[model samples]
Target chain A: MKMKYYSEAHEWIMIKDNEATIGISEYAAEELGDITYVELPIEEDDVTVGDTIGVIESVKAASDVYSPIGGTVTEVNAELEDNPGLINESAEKEGWICKLANIDVAEIGDMMTPDAYVKYLKSLD
Target chain B: MSDLEIKNTPLAECHKLAGAKMVDFSGWNMPVQYSDGILAEHKHTREKVGLFDICHMGEFRISGKAALEALDTIFARPVFNQRVGLCRYNFLLNKAGKVMDDLIVYRLAEEDFFIVVNAGTRAADSEMIQSQLPEDVVFEDVSDLTAKLDLQGPLAADILAKAGLKIADLPNYFNWTEAVINDIPVLLSRTGYTGELGFELYFDADKAADMWNYLLSFDGIKPIGLGARDTLRLECGYALYGHELTEDYTPLDAGYAPMLKLDDFPEREFTGKAALKALPVENKLIAITLEGRRAARAGADVLDASGTKIGIVTSGAFAPSLGAAIAMAYIESGKSLDIGDEVQLSAGRSTITGKISDLPFYKEGTVRKKL
Candidate 1:
């Protein structure tokens, strides 16, 4: 079964088999106001567990999207280059930012589950 | 203002009732956007009508037999010949000619004038203006009793008519007239910072909430927040106080020397006239459009084609009306950065490459539309 995990920084990663997909959480997207630009990571680039993989610019402010776990960027959502609103629309699904290869299954344990993430979001309030 | 206390506008409760996102803006609790969000509010203002709560802004009154003469000596621009009922954009400067605040002076009558200034700079501006006026000129801070609202867009007049708020006819652009909105006396001015055909309403603070609801009762009137306000003004290249205008830079440094007639007539004298004439343009404000959809916000680094650090961005945002990223920067003089010259804006880690462009990036604005 596929499993989704979240980071305290508001990034979400969905793991299925050997491939993992990453995107910003809905809470992060809403908090960013209106998404204007998304600096997608280059394919075939290596990333650390907490490295800032790319940048996101909203109408009100800008922030960095960090990778939840270290892996190689297999592919990036090229559609976001023209329509960053996808992050605001379906942040957890079609708005998946990038794909990671050579997944670190053990690191997924360190991330928060869906239920824990929801509670964490409330705590922020 | 201390973090322990946040000031609330007269319509703050009404804003919450409409589900607006409240933010601490310059210590005042203000709405950044309503339920429809920034994009929708911004687009509606362009294609339809939008209402803005501007109660946090400050207002002052100066009147006496010698009001004109005293005001002429105090203001950077000559205000003696300004006709009654007309409003003029002016600059209040310190001894060094730097802009203390940019304001609009409304000649309410022969010896009566009303001034509007930025909300954050109200206190200092009031003191500085009071210091310059002659003892005979009566000066009063009307900010506490006054509240401001803006009805802006192409269909602003239609919205007013729909709500049955008639003023015989809308005032001419840059002019104001005494009128009544929903039985509340208001000074209606045909001027706005959004570059849209709009009206600014000045009324009693106590009736602010009632007035807000009365306007929004119209079918197409949307409650816009400060977020869209920033984008709209930035697109028109209007200067924001902390951004394009500040105490450190003179009006000439900010590109208003020629418009203000700073050195045009060497014979005339005003506050800081000598310093203004002697000072050379330091960093010149120029408008630039980004090469892509990425917005280069304020505080970004501006570099020329050869990768020289020439200036820093004062204001930047994605122009909702034009569907492009636009910015204003103070490029240091002597670099000769001409229009159409390519430059790079270091916005965080990524760079937004763009060319020097003219102001009012969104030209379709209806600010000058004749009724």
Candidate 2:
């Protein structure tokens, strides 16, 4: 089963075996309003925990996407180049920003689980 | 304004019920966008119709026999020639020839006029005008008692008909007429910030919710928030109050030389007339369009090809209508830049390449459509 983890910064990472897919959480997507442009990380680029992997510009403001766990960027979502609204439609699935490989699986233990993330979101209110 | 607490419009409850996301705008809690988002709301206004709650804007009624000559001597525009039922966009300049506010003057009758000013500059505008006007003239700030709504789009007329509102004669462009909507008296103007066929309606604040709900109940009309309002105005190259018109810059810098009527009415006298005549034109406002959706927002440094700063962006946005980013910047006067000239703007951690375009980035607006 794929294990989903969420960071305090509102990024979500879905891990299956040793590979993980990362994207912004639905809450973050809604807060940003409409996504206009995104600058993604390059494939084969190594990123550390809390490193800004990309930049997302919305209609209202610009935000940086940070990696919660260290890994190598195996692939970037090419579909977002023309249609960034996919992030607003389905931020967790088809809107996944990037794929990570060669990651330290133990680093994700500090992140929140799906249920824990739900409880954490409630606390924000 | 008496307390530190933020103020809410009379239609606040209605906006919340419509799933609006609220934001603090000039000390008032206003909707930034509804559930449809800015892009969708923007396109809807362009294609269909959108309703905007603009009650936070300030309204002042100036009357008396001396009002006409007094106003003619107050604003940059030649108000003496402004006919009744006509609306004129004018500038309120400080003694230093800088813009205190950009307002609209509506001549209700001979010696009777209504002035609409920006919400943020309401208090200052009131103080300035009150200080300048003769004591015999009557000046009353009726902002609290008034609620303003803008019904904008190509289909705005159809929506007005659908709502069962009647006008003896539809006001011409930049003209206003008194009408009744849902048994409430209103002053309807055929004008808007968006480059679309629209109307601005002013009515009693007590009936704000009723008017908002009654108009939005129509099929084609949807409630648009301030987010789409900003993009819509920017796309049409309209100068926003705080962004494009500020105390730091003179009206001449914002490209209102003709309104000054320095040559047309050389003998005309106003508060800043002498300073405006003496002040050298230092900057010129130019429109720039980017290649993509990344916006070079206000305060971004505009640079030349060699990376030397030449100007600063005043207002910008990712225009939903054009599907690209556009900006208005004030470059140094006599830069010798022509249309289609390439330039650069500074963004976060990078520089965006742009080109000098015409005044309006979007051209197919229906604002001047004939009835």
Candidate 3:
């Protein structure tokens, strides 16, 4: 229920008090139907914007989920390791991939707001 | 990827109205699934009946005085003496003994043959077959002119019967017969990609949309798409073109050497006979059933318990019927794996452990069921 920021690659990030949580947008999850596996990043691992953090394999294809903001990895959704379908069920809430600390809020300008992303998704069609 | 033009099938409009998710499959715009989703569609095909549009597959007509001889010489399997009504699973091989494509040879008559091949390899297979045939052979690429539909599952026959198809006159397994459904002539064959009692109907491309709509009108017949089609075939341990049978691998590597039938037909000489006999089979295809919900996808590295790489996964999917993830891999020849031997697949950053299972991860398919 936080204002979500979406990336052009279809990943969404929710920031609160310098802590950023990230997951793939609903658009991305629906496109990649039946997520069979998700490779989550490790805790304490360093990540930067545009870094390839993990891979998500769906029924159709395997894709790299990129990090939208620069920060230190604090936690990964371990539930995804056993049940990646959680992402398909609830992409925005329980399906959050990872949480990042020490976030560079300046990068938010490069990302799209919820309304802007809605327009962005339509342009893709 | 968008630079290449995507082609639509004759039934594309029907799929659009049915709310199907269209994807570019081998240059043809095809539906990956309808609104029912893959799991529901897959289960429906097992319990009820599901219809699939397979117009993307390539069909060729080869007829001549030496048609059987030309076919036998080109394919790896012995196509000669195949009965007029029976459809024989055949293969085309390169000079290097590698599999070019796996096809079905439908003997319409003594000298006339109907060959069905993969969409991506259609042009290449035509060229290869043409090069080996004499000038008198009539070769026609009917892919553009033909459309195919597969009606599968336990209730397929009943549904087709209700739709005005002569169920009693239907061909036996791997056999073909000319029939009419909704007044449209079709070459009906009791064969399907799904491991179910099914019928593959072929007719004019222009009638595809009409036939598709007509089939849907029957009770318990839902439209299935490629997503369920892939999982259904995988559960049945069927080899797909790009996944299991590829240009880099031979039928022997895919654990289909027994189908070569050299013991029965020792005198038959196919295109890659000498080279195939000369080459050593360095790998064997194994079916692995995972322990959990995760699937080991294609290109995933297969490693032993010690973490040493032993093979590469060719195809993997979550088998809904079995409630486990399954995969087919080409393991090293000398590495032996028992039914319970534990193996790991490097699925991205995570590794999945599984056991080497038998040919069909899911048993009880009605593929060979007699009515």
lDDT at B255 for candidate 3?
83
Model 3 misses residue B366 by how many Å?
Answer: 1.8
In Å, residue B276's CA in model 2 sits off its true spot by 1.6
User: DockQ for each of the predicted structures, in order?
Assistant: 0.81, 0.82, 0.41
Candidate 2 at B284: error in angstroms? 1.5
Clashing pairs in 3: none
- In CAPRI terms, model 1 is classed as high
What's the TM for model 3?
A: 0.91
Q: Which candidate tops DockQ?
A: 2
In the predicted model 1, the residue pairs found to clash are: none
Score every model by TM-score. 0.97, 0.97, 0.91
Say which candidate scores most in lDDT: 2
Compose the digit string of candidate 3's lDDT tens values, residues B67-156. Answer: 888888999888877899999888999988788899999999988999999988998999998999988889999999999999999998
- lDDT of each residue in B7-80, candidate 2, tens digit only: 99999999889999999999999999999999999999999999999999999999999999999988888899
Estimate the lDDT of model 3: 0.89
- Predictions in order: lDDT: 0.89, 0.91, 0.89
For model 1, how does the per-residue alpha-carbon lDDT over B45-143 read when each residue is reduced to its tens digit?
998999999999999999999998888888888788799989999999888888889999999989999999998899898999888888899999999
Off by over 4 Å in 1: B1-4, B165-168, B263-265
Model 1: how far residue B152 lies from native, Å: 0.3
